[model samples]
Target: MQPWFVYRKCSNRSCDMCIYFLVLFASVCLQVQIKREKALDITSEHLIKAMADQMANEGWRELGYVYLSIDDCWTKKQRDPNGRLEPDPDRFPSGIKALADYVHSRGLKLGIYSDMGNYTCGGYPGTTLDTIKTDAETFSSWEVDMLKFDGCYSNDTEKAIGYPKMSSALNATGRQILYSCSWPAYEGGLPPKVNYTQLGNICNMWRNYGDIQDSWASVLDIIKWYAVNQDVLQPTAGPGHWNDPDMLITGDFGLSYEQSKAQLAIWAILAAPLIMSNDLRTISQEAKDLLQNRLLIYINQDSLGIQGRQIMKVDCLGVWKRELVNGQYAIAVINMGDDGLPRPFTTSLGLLNVTQCPVGYKLYDVFDRNYLGLFNSETTFNLKINPSGVVMLFIQPASVVNHMKRHGSYFG
Candidate 1:
């Protein structure tokens, strides 16, 4: 089922730039309402616990989905008289510090959200230029491991100054907060318009596109944008600095089972952050299984950290490749069509610019969890991909494949 959407009128003193935040507010509310239905009045605190317990017990945390982020609207509508951000009394009576402690106790990290303007997108209190230091210290004191600093109710010049200043403020706190910036997404996520080198210096990851909605169309739109801008986005992404395509809406109302798998596969291939924005308590078993896919998660967390690039696109089918540690690669063939049938296609590694290995590479299916055998660069891989689905393979050199099999470690 889809979540109810909320629309809050822009009530901040900032200029007309707030209209942009109102739109983002309405979209993010969809995901928030879904979680609310799962936990009712104890939504904020109990929901975090539920997510933490699930992540720990269900093997998701071990698979590298560590951070449980609290998004907009978690704060009070107005700051305390001392100009400090406070958790909403009605929603989070135990407060954000207690929540962060609980998350850390579960061997997980906590991420909180705020804006770089007078108010958050959800109309909650935000950090202005004068209050940046206070908010940064508050987050550190609460033991917040990450901060998703959003762009709302502010202009370009304010963003340019505020983003860097906030980074400095965060560093001064002497806490290791993973800064997720929205500055570039507001500036069109490209060079001249977006200074990625500056972003890399400030943010650990940055959103590069519109917020993802819970639908196959929304997923397709994001993938298409990344493909179109691959040359620009790919090089800028690496170990600590990543190009976020927004959250994983898998197991939510919008995508089919195939589409859910496709989303997880492609997100891993892109080396994007695997932040799930769905209700964990009610997710379907199929969706749960896909979220916990070990091979896919391993490929995503590869030490190489190179972002994948789209190699070919033919009508409904598109192929992408990411270089991995130990000379391996992750290749994804996605079908983004709606013809209601799986499309059969063929391709070779040579066409993907993969040079011949001393011994042919072994093709292992990430979702199916089966080895498709060794193939040289000239060998054609015939594949049938479901509409709005994907076929993800890990290409490992024979030497490493033999060593992994010998040690009984397949996804290593």
Candidate 2:
């Protein structure tokens, strides 16, 4: 998934303005929503309200707030008279519209979930070919800013028809609602059926993998999938269309502090969406530290829009690298093994994928938040990686870093 970029203010009159416009388009159109998935099975109006407020106030890097998303179980068992879906009255006492107003009051958008089948994955009534348009209208009327269209009880052909149909229906509403399609994942992620180009035209982001549970095993599973399939899948992701490895589970209970940092590093290296899936109000300070890591956030939000890849992996130890927008790189050294103690892992600049950066690179340790002098091509840097842990480095050519210091700025 590693790709290089050459972005600068175009001075040549002969340059194709279309290329710059496409980059700007991806930057604006693709990242239209600030999304956060509600904690699974425990979603409610009060919970969403609290999390939304927290997202706005917490020291979240770059994108300060998020669209509060209700996953499943928010809707009633069936629809109302106008064929519009209804929220569970008890769970959503003020209703979705009123809750939406409250969220908007804080400058946050509200997102709702749905399936393109007879029933939602949570067994709530989902929209079919018959009700998709009406449902889209209903969401717009209620001030929903994002729609996560899932596939559960539908076949592949049904998915191809219904998912895009829903996108069209949403567009017809004359509301700029962000559409997140789950079609590629249902088709096992990209072959003859999953068209990445069309998905980009339709969705702000699409899931092309399994849901991430809160466990080291789940984290490794996703990392492995990306590592094995990045060549085919990485090019498919950019600003507006992302290969979602699912939500960030850092602030949740399943992963240890070290393991949580690993997940964050890998996700940021991949430039994946930063949709949190944990309960913000109840998260620990350690988890919050990982979630709000400034360096990691900068990497994920880089406009370069290139996902990183594992350049080398041996015996569960690996190195992942991504090119930065400012002609630098973000490198991650991962230790996925079950070593009882710190394992010595090492690599050098020459081994990394990109050929632009010559020899010596000034590096910043993302987790430690400190400068690591200078690492040249011949220098074999060694890191004692803990079990299931990662060491993330933001790397830059020494000349560029020195220039930044002279100008009182730092490379991302």
Candidate 3:
């Protein structure tokens, strides 16, 4: 008998037993797959404990996979005689598996790094052009949950096939590990292609752009570019698959609190993955608040998983919007001008045609948690958005508004 047949026999016999068994089996399979893919990437292993602690304290319940992703320089130039990738003893003297266990004990997952070429981006040895299967198995034995596969030294002649080959090797291990393709799209004369569907078929997420630096221009350019091409990637992103725009620059960068908030806000609107990139061990309270802005993060994690798009643009002023699964609207009014003070901006709620009649709409400022009373059929509000900052609001049906008014004390 098949393995599933025995599992079915062990369950209580009911008319729906067979169907329930099949569903249960499928659900288990899917959970295993998703467990492999869920992840957050980190570069500094030194901050592993602190990162895990912060995530837990902030009520981040499902950070199942905490990838200790070694960006570069975490390996030696040669594998050991046993054919396993050797870690830089100076940095990880306790061995990789010990670190993986530490993360696992904290209720997080672990990940590692390798390149497709003979050497890593930091000139360490890569698994590419070598024993790919063996390298994958080594990671599996070490309890790695994710792998960031970079295209650092991969030759142009081999780049196209290298990623898929590594993915196949990882899958062969039957260990259910996530593969992150880090091929910089801008290089190699490639088209403006983010083939998320094809990539998602094998890997969890792929870097669609180059390295994201800690600069406002870097963040702004990436967001603008992604907004224009988001439709092309919509089909590929969902609960299990995502389009990674790279890591969040929230904590220890030179950015001010306002700038960090702006970065987090735009990224959340874009539905970008929230893998943080700063030294979390000593992150400041302001930085932590910026990273854990519940309202903004909720927009990113909305069930709809729809990336926000630019609905309107004036030279230095813009409006971007996304729809939540609960029939609410998330709108952001952005000011790109140089002025430091907040400037007034407005957008028509009717243009969104949110309600069946495009009338009787009530708005709530998501940031301030204050409800703005009813407005005209073509609802508009003068929002004060700081330079490169946003005024985000959620529009709800008038019924919700009435309910809130009737039970104001209850809601409070």
Candidate 4:
């Protein structure tokens, strides 16, 4: 069999064989160890501090969030005289390293943004092909924990070359930095030129679609796109690699309380990254509660790491189910309508594609944090879904450890 390594002169046959096995081992088992991203937009230091505080202290860290990322516009309009990217002196009074230190002090990692072209999306300096390695070193020097590399202002050829080159440069830094790319998104998210396998090997997580504005319409569009294309998207996400659905707008305006819940619940079900991007300090208490929902976070962080799919959708009612690490399932009953009234919906084990869903599952309501009681395969589960809301549940199978077995219906 051909070796996985690039051609290199072997010192000896044993050395060559050793190199081959090591490369093979890494190819098979070394995942990037990056699975979450909480992307922030260009903002002042105070706002970034607030987001870091919320993510670290307000119950999101325990949910497996690893990086608190800053998106575009963190830098000045031009590189410094030394050809190094510099943070806006006024916005970041303490500099990028200081901000990174603050985030680290809060028990969180810091992420900064860059573009593969001449300028970032916000018209700030970028890490174009000429500066890719320098930019990588700059981020590493700043002790940045992650990078959200955008594909703005570049031709297809430039992106195809620059994106991978940047990834290589990052690896060469010898620092444990996660790479989040917009390459696949610029390539239109699939097929012809999009190579998911290579992406998994290169990028830790990648934006697969458009940016999410702070609105329900944008959220709905992303959901719809993922639902239809999950066949190609789901298999590509797990552990170190993921399909980013952009930042979470849970605590932001443009979505009602119920609509925010839908966004959070659907994101959890999709096993997507929990990168929240909102004004955390000024966010409503209700939005904060939903954004930091423990059950939803647990489902999102489930080690099974399976992205959910829209198994059933009729009109505005839909069901999305994600297999969890515990042999249970995280399911979301979503109402897509805005009729200003609650809608009653129903589904069974078969409809959920659970096939032979056992009778001992203790379906717990994730939103209400109450037991919905045990159910059987033939059980008819009903939910009163609010308009543009979701009822996410964790149907935990009765285990020998929990001893929740009661072979029949057990309603509250």
Maximum-TM-score candidate: 1
What TM-score, over all chains together, does every model reach?
0.89, 0.86, 0.79, 0.84
Q: Which stretches in model 4 have alpha-carbon errors above 4 Å?
A: 1-42, 54-57, 355-359, 403-412
Clashes of each: 0, 2, 1, 1
TM-score of candidate 4 relative to the true fold: 0.84
What C-alpha lDDT, on a 0 to 100 scale, does residue 241 get in candidate 3?
Answer: 50
Q: Residue by residue across 92-148, what tens digits does model 3's lDDT show?
A: 667778877877786666767787888776677887655788888899888887778
For 1-412, candidate 1 gives per-residue lDDT tens digits of 1111111112211111100000001012223446655534445687788878887787666556677887877776788999999887756778889988998899778888889988888777878999999999999999997789999999898899999988888878877677789999898888898998887777777999988888899999999999998988898987667889988887779988889988888898898877787777788888888877767777776766788988889888989898987888999999988878899988877887776576778888888888898888888989999888899998888767464456334443
Name model 2 segments beyond 4 Å from true.
Answer: 1-42, 61-63, 353-359, 401-412
| Candidate 3 wrong stretches, greater than 4 Å | 1-46, 57-68, 184-194, 231-236, 339-341, 357-362, 374-377, 398-412
Flag the better candidate by TM-score, 1 or 2. 1
Q: Residue by residue across 1-412, what tens digits does model 4's lDDT show? A: 1111121112211111111100000000111343322122234676678777776676556545546676666677778998999887666779989988998898778878889998877677777888999999999999987777888899999998998898789878877676778999999999777999888777777899987887888999999999989899999887667788877777667898888888888887877767766665577888767765656666776666678888888788888889986577888988888677788988866667664445457678887777787777677988899988888887876542452344112121
Encode model 2's per-residue lDDT on 302-393: one tens digit a residue.
Answer: 77788888888867787888887767899888888876567787677776744465656777888887788787777777778888898888
Question: Would you list the C-alpha lDDT of every candidate in the order shown?
Answer: 0.78, 0.72, 0.61, 0.72
Model 3 TM-score, 2 decimals: 0.79
Cα error, residue 182 of model 3, in Å, equals 1.5
